[model samples]
Target: MAFSVLTINPGSTSTKLARFEGEGCVWQDVLRHTAEELAPFGTVSEQLDFRLGLVRSALAAHDGGAVRLDAVVGRGGIIDPLPGGTYRVDPVLVDRLRLGRPWDHPSNLGGVLAFSLADPLGIPAFIVDPVCVDEMAPEAKVTGLPELPKPSLLHALNVKAMVRRAAHDLGKTWNELNCVVVHLGGGVSVVAHRGGRAVDVNSANEWGPFSLDRAGGLPVGEFVRLCFSGRYSEGDIRRKLTSGGGLRAYIGTNDMLEVNRRIQAGDDEAAFYCRAMIWQIAKEVGAQAVSVGGPIDAVILTGGIAHDAGFVRLLLERVQWIAPCLVYPGEDELLALAQGALRVLRGEEPAQDYASSVLRQ
Candidate 1:
């Protein structure tokens, strides 16, 4: 029996839609939004109607109106920390997404958009392995300062998907292997997966190797002094740390291809910064190796940046000794979302309820 699932992933300037029949995607499209178009919306929640309209139009245009959908799944947003799985989008979850608790991001619109589409059809709506999935051990949460405990935020959708893929390739169940999964994208997350649970990770937004955009972990003393210097505002500092830093801060651009082009042109500075970033990634992989506390089954590299063969070759040279490196490039999040919902619809895995899974801070 085939289950038809519509997967929605709302990014900063694009809403990706995919219609899947069982494990295969029959149709997919990316709806691009310009700055002027999105400028009217004050908050992410406010764009619910706007995004929903676009999704509806896209579906209708693509003959999705004639296709019967069994389930609708969206990319999970930053909600309360919870275990990773396919989650049924309930009223409690909807309310939370509308409120945009924790923070207001474009991803918050995912669940709401999914529910709006699925509700009228009387089909189940779900979110898969959102950014807030927290499976960290108690010890891993502690830091030098008791108040500033580590947070579990990563590319959970892609990280977990790649981990499962690695297990599948190894001909082992996810619970049977310990894997270190690294998602190298605009931001990077190096996660230590032990027995299928992410026990430790460098939260992509706050810590880890500096990526194409993010600053990653920084020296606290200098950072604190800079914060107190009053040369920049809170938002400015945050933008610097999250987006304005990293390769963009060191070089002029964040595109790996452009960086490689510069390196090929004998631009020594570009090559130096690129290699330094890779070195940081290798170091973080080693740290996660200790976090798992035993022999690692594999070190998985994924996400958009992993598509660069030269970058992957350089990174593999550094971390391959820890474990056999598995490269599954590109974050195919729409497919991952569809697979999560299909697992529930097929009864292969029970769909988790959002109310019950909410982690109490």
Candidate 2:
């Protein structure tokens, strides 16, 4: 069998699978399920059974095609600061990921499923930029408690990788460019890149101003009081933080497309929330420019929201004078995953090691 790499992205209700051999795509498909279908899984691993089963069936039916991979990579969503490059999933990281049940990001399960599938098939299993590759600068990783610092989960891999490719295509380099990469999706994150590193960004909740389904950066004292006031249980607070915060917090909906439709119909509430979302995104972009200490080379907007001209227009208007704004809207995560795996396959980069023992006891 020819060596290949499979990239699986397990979303909240959708699992996207794609196979790439060398520079070309072999197979790509999305298996969608209802929320109820996933609710019974209990853990991310259990859900993997369902997701992989779906993929197996899909593979069986993919135009009579049969292909296995040399390396199986999934968009790992929980691992942190793993050298900002492709890596073989280590047992240490996997153990921590499986046991660390505090995080509830849907994409967190992507890595577990990749490992589970790869092990049975006797192929390398890995995750690309799980929880993003952007490790914030030590000074930028501050929490209210002087002693407690945390890393931010910005889409560092996708943003940086895509920008690097874009710059290269234009005969430029990332270190020579300062740009804003906007990630618009269910979970939105915009990163400011400078000198090939993500200096300052709104990757974590403590820093983000807001997002489509996130409350974003907020006043910690007020949030702590709200958490301590006995009005919300820990679970309730988590739900709000993970999936209920943003516009959904105010209007009970997270679909920006639907929100736009309602706005066209003259629903003042929808319009108001839409405007707020755009405004908040613009504000964050401004902050990113400032973080780079001004004179940003360009503002590059990409993501689901960047596809929406109206939203893009709003952002452009908000910061047109800042610098030239470029849009690469829509996600290239699958592309980045494939490219990373290919780098290893072609000997451009090293493969991730998965057999190492866990570091934390």
Best by TM-score: 1
lDDT of each residue in 1-361, candidate 2, tens digit only: 3457778887778989887776578778889899788878777756756777887787678735456568777787764454366767656666756663556666766777778777877877777765646545666667567777556677765677767766775578756887776777777677777777777778545456567778877787899999999999998997888778988888778887887888788899977777887788888888888777757777778777778888888778987787777778778787678777777777877876544321121
Q: Rate the local accuracy (lDDT) of all candidates.
A: 0.92, 0.73
**Which pairs of residues clash in candidate 2, taking residues 3 or more apart in a chain or in different chains?**
76-130, 87-352, 88-352, 89-354, 90-354, 208-217
lDDT of 1 at 291: 99
Per-residue lDDT of model 1, residues 1-361, tens digit only: 6898999999899999999888888889999999999999988898888899999999999973788889999889998999999999988899998888789988888988999999999999999999999999999999889889999998999998888888999999987789899999999999999998999999778887998988999999999999999899999999999989899999979988999999999999999999999999999999999999999999999999888999999999999999999999999999999989988988889999999988886
Worst 10 residues of 2 by lDDT: 352-361
